[model samples]
Every structure is written in C-alpha cells, then in structure tokens.
Target: MKDSPSRPLYLAPYYIWIALFVIAPIALIFYFSFLDLTGAFTLENYQNFFSSVYLRMTLSSFWYAFLITLITILIAYPTAYWLTKTKHKQLWLLLIIIPSWINLLLKAYAFIGIFGLYGPANKLLQALGAGPLQILFTDFSFIFVSVYIFIPFMVLPIFNSLDKINPALIDASRDLGASSFTTFRRIIFPLAINGVKSGVQAVFIPALSLFVITRLIAGNKVITLGTAIEQQFLVTQNWGMGSTIAVFLILFMIIIMMLTGQKEKGGLYNGKTK
Candidate 1:
C-alpha cells in the first residue's frame, strides 16, 4: 500500500500551512514559557501559575467548562435524537445552526439586552407579579450564555452519529422482543458514544479558553484561565506567564482529544466488532 514519493507532494500546502500557522505559534509560546519578563531563561512563569491566586482561577475555568459541557450534553442528546425522528430534519438543524452564523460579539450583545435590568427577563417577571431579579453579570448568566453559545457544537456531532445508525438493526431488535427503551439502552447509546465524546471535546476545550462571554456577562467576579491569560499578556504585559497558561491550555486540549479517540467503529447492533 505504499505510495510513490511524489504522493506527499499533494500535501505540501497543508504541511506548509500547519508549519506556519500552528507549529510555529506553539513553538514560540513554549519558548516564551521558559523565559522571564526580561527575556532571560527562568522558572518564574511556572512558579507564578502554581501560586494560589492563579491556581484558583485555573480551577474555576475548568469547573465552569465542565458545567457547560454537562448541560449541553443533557440538552443536545434529546434534541439530536428528536431531530433524527423529525420529517424536516434539515430545516430544524438549520434553525439550530442559524445563531452561530451571527458574530459572537453580537450574540453576547443581544443577550445583554435580555438580561439587562429593565430587559425582557425583568419585564416577564413583573408581568408574573414576581418582581425583577438581577441576572446580568452573575454566575447564572455566565453559564446560560456559555450553554447557548456552544449547544450546536454538541448537537451536530451527536446528530451525525444518530443519522448514521442502521434502521434494520432497530427492526431486528424489535423482532427479537426487545422493547424500545431496552433497545436504545443496549444498542443505540453505546454506538453513539463516539459522538458524545466528540461533542464534549468540541465544547469543553474552547469553553476552557473563552474569556469574552465571561467578560461581557460575568464581569470581574469571574476569572477564567482565558481571562487570566489575557490579563498577563495584555493588561499586565507579562508574556512569560501568559505563554505558560497558553501552553497548559494546549496540553489540556491534547489530553481531551486522546481520551475521546475511538478504539473501534460500529454502525449496527450485531454485538460484533469490525
């Protein structure tokens, strides 16, 4: 199955792109992580990260990301399953995807109106005679916006996995006296777990690195790894510490991808490995 040496020539552009955009930037960040503010080699950057203040921020970033991923999975699994059963799947998927087409800033801005003091949330509560409740810049608002932004990343992968399922397997399960719920528990869910892994990978890693929504919605009360990285690099002009955070972030992402990778593929319920 070995190809001619020229075969790799077709991938020259891809290799170049990866070298210039991906590898080079990561190399620079790794190099900077080893240096201090004066461009001298030192371990201060690493020390600063393990310090209590920054360590807490790192944990908070992961905690919120976990919550976002959990909620997204709970909502996306059912929605994706429903979409598979719908007559107009494409239209429904488009509706789910349409919001992503809008700019992230614009979407955050739109939510600002909804969560503002005199906005729809307060208005609706007033109508219910429950009075206004503050949501803007709170932890609840932060989680809500994260889930809203990342739900599609979760749904699309699960939907693709579900749509790829074989109908005959379900029919055979029924003919063999398996109930719908039993069939799903034993057959459907295990097969679709690859998609769940993919969805979690897509949502959680980026959530760990996002600061914008936290900034606009959660304000100074919430400090994530992304916000801390931004502060070290931009606000504090501490590139070494920022690059250290960026390196660890990349490390965490790699760990997630490895954990999510499939050991095998199955498209039908034969209780067989192919």
Candidate 2:
C-alpha cells in the first residue's frame, strides 16, 4: 500500500521542533564544552570537571538529589495510599495537587517568610521555650521545601499505580491470611514498582539539577551541579565550563533514565507453559 502524501507533512512540525529545541541546544552545548573561554578548542573544561572541586560538587548534588527523592517517596507513598482509600479520592488528590499549581518562586518566597527569624516556625519554637532557630538557609529547610514541591509529582504516579491494582488481588491476599505489611510487600508494591520508578525518574532528575531552591532555601550553602552550571554561565561568564557540566549532566540524566526505565515483558502471565 502507498503511504499518504500528507503523513510527512503532518510530521514536519514535530521534527522541526525537536531539531530546534532539543537537538540544536544539545549540539551547541557539546560544541561549547570543547572550547575554552577564548573560544579556542580545549580539553581543559573536561579536565577541570574531574578535579577535586567539581568532583565534590557532583557528589554533593547526587547526595541531595537522593535525599530529596527518598524523602519525597516516604511522604508521598503514604499520602497516595490514603488518598486511594478516601471516599472522594479525586477530590483529595486535587487538593494535594493544587499547591503544585502555584508558582515555584512564590512558594519559595512564602517559605522564606515562614522560616524566617520571626516567622511562624520560630515563633512556635519560642513559644515552646526552645527559642527561634535558624531555619532559613539551612539544609532542613531546603530539603523540606524541595520535598513539598516534588510530593505531588511523586504522588500522582504512585497513586495511579496503586489505584490500578485489582481489588480482587488485594482481597485474595487478605483471604490468604497475609498481614497488611506482607500484602503490601508481596503484592501491592510489586505491582506498583513501575509507578515508583516513574516517580523516581520524575523527581530525581529535576532534583539533581535544582538551583533556585538551593539558592532561595539553602542560601547557597548547598550547591548542586545545576547551581555550579548557573554560576559558570551567569556569574562567572564561563560558558565552556558551564557547557562541560551540562554535557555531563545530560549524560547523568541519560544513565538515570536507563536505570529507571521500564522493560516490556509478560504481563501477569506469558500465556505459555513451562
């Protein structure tokens, strides 16, 4: 059969969009990574990225991203589980997601006030006789705000996964005398593993590249690779080093995607005898 003449026409815009937005920017970054500040080709940027300073920064970025992802999962999973059990599950989920619709900068600034010296957090502490503690510009605040921002992202995927579970399977587990923990560990979580993977991919990748939250919430005390890239490009005007970091960040993102990516195989059963 002959193909439709309009098929390629239909796809042209998509191809052009990918080329301009995705391919072109990456090619530019890769090209820039090999250049020095003077626009001369050099490997110095790559060499410098492997140095102790950048190595420490990279490790710190990974650490914070891991912590944020882990904490988000801990909080989001239980919340999602409860949401699934609610009488008005969609309404509850909507409430949870509503906060995420607010501008991230607005939320950050709001937290800045909430965590400030005389803010409600400190006021509560003082009321309890512990005195106002330094909450803003601290690791706790940074992680807290990041977790708050990412919870909805994590919850949605997990909730969808959990919601898709056949009630019969859960009932079967219960009928078999499995404890709630055992049922979750053996049945529910295994089925929802893909959703957890999706959530991890959604949360972890952005967490690694977080700069604004680190600056606004952590007061530049916690510098991720994204912050370093921002400094290189904007603050220091070193596009080469920034692109170098970006190239590696892209590589990291690819590796993480690969690690978390789902594999297609038999579902429930392969319909074959062993």
Candidate 3:
C-alpha cells in the first residue's frame, strides 16, 4: 500500500483541484465574513445577526425548514418501508429518482401547474362545488413543494437503512410476544435512526438554503435566512451582512452534523454492511 512516485503523480491533480476550488473559496468566505462595508475589519455584522429581528428571522427559517424535514420523514418513512417490501424494488427506486433528473427550478415550477390558483387541484375542487381554494404563495405551498423536492433525500437513506435490518429479527420479536408496532418502535426505528439522521440533514440543510422556490411560491413576503442572504447580496449590495449570515448558516450546519454524527458514531451499528 506504499505510495510510489507514479501514485503521487496520479493523485496530484485531484489534490491541486481541491486546494484551488474548495479550499480557496472557503478561505475567501472566512475572510469576507469578518469584514465590514468599508473594507475594515469588524464584528458589527455578526452582532446585528444576533439582534432580535435577525435572530427571530433566523429562528423562523430554522423552524420552517425543520417542519419540512419532519414532514418529509413522516411521509417518506412509510413509503420507503413499503418500497423495501415491494417486488420491484429497482423500478420503485428508479421512479423515486426520476424527479431528481429534472432541473430543480423546473421541478419547483411544475408544482405551480398542480397547485396554482387555476391549477388542477383547485379546478377539480371548484368543479365538485368544494369552492375555490388558495394553494399558492403561502407557507403551505412552500412546505408542499419543499417536501416534494426533498423526498428522495429522505427516502433513499431510510431505504438503505431499512434494507440492512434482518427480517428474522421481526419474526423473532413477533414470536416473543411483540406486536408489529411494538417491534418497529423498539427495534426497527432505533436501528434506522442513523439513516434518518443522514436523511434529515440532507433535506433540512438544503431546504434551509432554498431561496428561489421561496421567492416564487411564497411571494417574497416570507423571508427566511436564505432570502435574507440573497437580498443582502443582490438587492441591498451588503456583501458584509450576506457573508455573515452565510457564515452563521455554515456554523449551524456544522453544529448539527457534530451533534448527529456523535449520536450515530456512538450507536450500536457496527459498520456491518448489508
């Protein structure tokens, strides 16, 4: 396993690419996050980010993204669990992944087709005398589209985790006087939590960063940290504040990963590949 000259040369390009592209940008972000509008070093932006208004906005953003993450897990868990028991697992997986192949903007816009004021769902409801329904430009629409867009993230992890469970465990639980719900709660759910953690991170982080979909569907009235960052950069030209928020978001992500990763690493899962 010793690295030869040829091996070092072969991997040099990837190392250089990582250093230039990834490391360089991160370094720049770190630098910018500490600067002020006048090119002077300052902590004013960070202080403002913790003020009541900005803090409330950031908390609201986390809360909404959290709601989206919870909803995605609740919906995807059952779907993924059922899919694992299906006869055509590959086909189901393909179907699940098909939406991801479409452009994210296109997929977000496609929801407009089904949930807009004159969209099919509303039209059908009106035709049935259920009256017109408001579906777009609201938190509800935001949650719905976010869930749809991120479902695959939640599902894939759960599916992978569920696939590792020995079915015989369930049979044994049943024979030992446990009901289906009890066994799942006691055995299946605990074991699958790692996957759940991974899936939730995948969904929540990106969902928190979503600005385009929020702008389009939430009428730009609802402002999350994502929207705040975008407005700071694009609208207000306040790169200092934008970078501060971005840095905060990155810190928040790291904190979440550390907490979840600790739980995962300390768990009973012994790296047994299924």
lDDT leader: 2
Per-residue lDDT of candidate 1, residues 124-182 (tens digit): 98999988888899999999999998888788778888888998988889999999999
Error of 2 at 6 (Å): 7.6
Q: What does the lDDT read for residue 129 in candidate 2? A: 96
Residues 55-107, candidate 2: write the lDDT tens digits: 99999899999999999999999999889999999999889888878888999
Q: Candidate 1, residue 269: CA error in Å?
A: 25
TM-score of 3: 0.90
Error of 3 at 267 (Å): 15
Please give the distance, in angstroms, between residue 89's alpha carbon in candidate 1 and its true position after superposition: 1.1
Candidate 2 ranges beyond 4 A from true positions:
5-11, 263-274
Give Cα distance to truth, residue 20, candidate 1, Å: 2.9
